[model samples]
Target: MFFALSKVLGFFALPSNLMISIGLVGALALFAGWVRLGGALLVISVLTLAVLGLSPLGNILLLVLEDRFPKPAENDNRPVAGIVVLGGSFDTIVAGARGEVALNESAERLTVIAELAKRYPEARIVFSGGQGTLFYSGATEAQVAARMFESFGIAPERITLEDRSRNTRENAVFSRDLVNPGAGERWLLVTSAYHMPRSVGCFRAAGFPVDAFPVDYRTRGYEDMTRPFRSVGEGLRRVDIAVREWVGLFVYRITGYTDALVPAPL
Candidate 1:
């Protein structure tokens, strides 16, 4: 029930979807002769879209989340018992059809596998992801990741695949159950920079304490805060990503998925 509700509500909650819906509704209202109401809605829709798509607001919002958890220091030599990489780095639909591993914009989540494998030869690796779409598809993200890992020459015994989890919370819960790391052992969580806060919160809430290994940063740094996007599509995409994450963070906290509103490094 929670998964279904989250998916449905999440669709409408996206800034792009909301703005597009408003524009469509306004068009329909104008067609029905609701002049004043239609004009107001249309004006609001256009202005909101312009602000989201042309301004630096998205970068500013993303920076707040991305900067919440920094990448582990270069000199912090720590023993990692295991590593967990969340899904959403692959395009399961394309991969399933083509029989080839296809990565999306979040490919860094998977590309980092090679570096990690070299760094921690002894650490067990867990890849957690399942079909997240409302409609059932034969493809699973974990399967695609498995192929990629094999191509990377990672040892089979060192890798564990948890393919049933469809969201971040389940990724943490299922990965923890699958590995059951020893107390005080360190585990590294690899995911996108903007997603680290919620990802960390979920793992912490599930009693799995893992250090953040953030990758796939969308923003350069504080400098991006003042820069406007040249392409409206690019800006809108960033805004959608940032807004969705912020909404997810709030929803997760209020729903008791995690005690922290914004999980910080220990």
Candidate 2:
């Protein structure tokens, strides 16, 4: 139920979608003779879009989430018992239709996992993700990930696909049960940088102790705020991603799905 509701709410929560909705309301008001109210709402929606797409607000908002968890040091040689890579990296629908693995903006999550697999040859690799879309019955993210992993030369026996989870909470619970790590075993959680906070919190709440391995960074740094908007579409998209992540943290915390609103590295 939460998964379905989250998806529905997420669409309406996007900056672009919200603006369109508000504009539509305004248009309806105008047609009904509420000229003043219609004009006000129209202006508000346009201004909202302008601010989100042209100003530094979107970049700053994204930076806050991306900076919440820094990437691990290059030479930190921590022994990883297992590696858990969350989904949202593959275009499962397209992959299923085209018979090819297609990656999305979050492809870094999977790419980083591949590299880590080579470095930590003994570590078990677990891909936790199921069908997250609504009404689209295609290949699961885990199935595509398995094909990708094999193409990268990762042994079939080394990969464990927890393909039943549809959200981050499920990802943690399902992956933990699938891996069933013994005492003192350390697992590394890999996902987009902006999503690491909630991901880590969920894992901790599920009694799965894993180090954060954030990838797919969207922001360059704080300096990105100084640069002009390269593309209004891209800026608005980033704002949507940031807002969705923030909402996820809030909802997960309130629902007791995570240990913290913003999980910190230990």
Q: Best candidate per TM-score, number?
A: 1
Weakest lDDT window of 10 consecutive positions for candidate 2 = 226-235
Deviation in Å, model 2, residue 217 alpha carbon: 0.8
| lDDT for model 2 | 0.89
The candidate maximizing lDDT is 1
Task: Report, for every candidate in turn, its global Cα lDDT versus the true structure.
Answer: 0.91, 0.89
Question: Please, what are the lDDT tens digits per residue for candidate 1 over residues 1-266?
Answer: 87888889999898988988998899899999998888888999999998899999999999998999988888877888889999999888888888999899999999998999888898998999999977657579999999999999999999999999999999989998999989999999999999999999999999999999999999999999999999888999999999999998999899877759888888
1-266 per-residue lDDT for model 2 (tens digits) = 86788899989988889997999999999999999999999999988887787777777877887888877799989888999999999888898899888899999999887789999999999999998898687789999999999889999999999999989999999998888988899888899888999999999999999888888888789899876577777778878888888888999999999999898887
**lDDT (0-100) at residue 247 of candidate 1?**
92
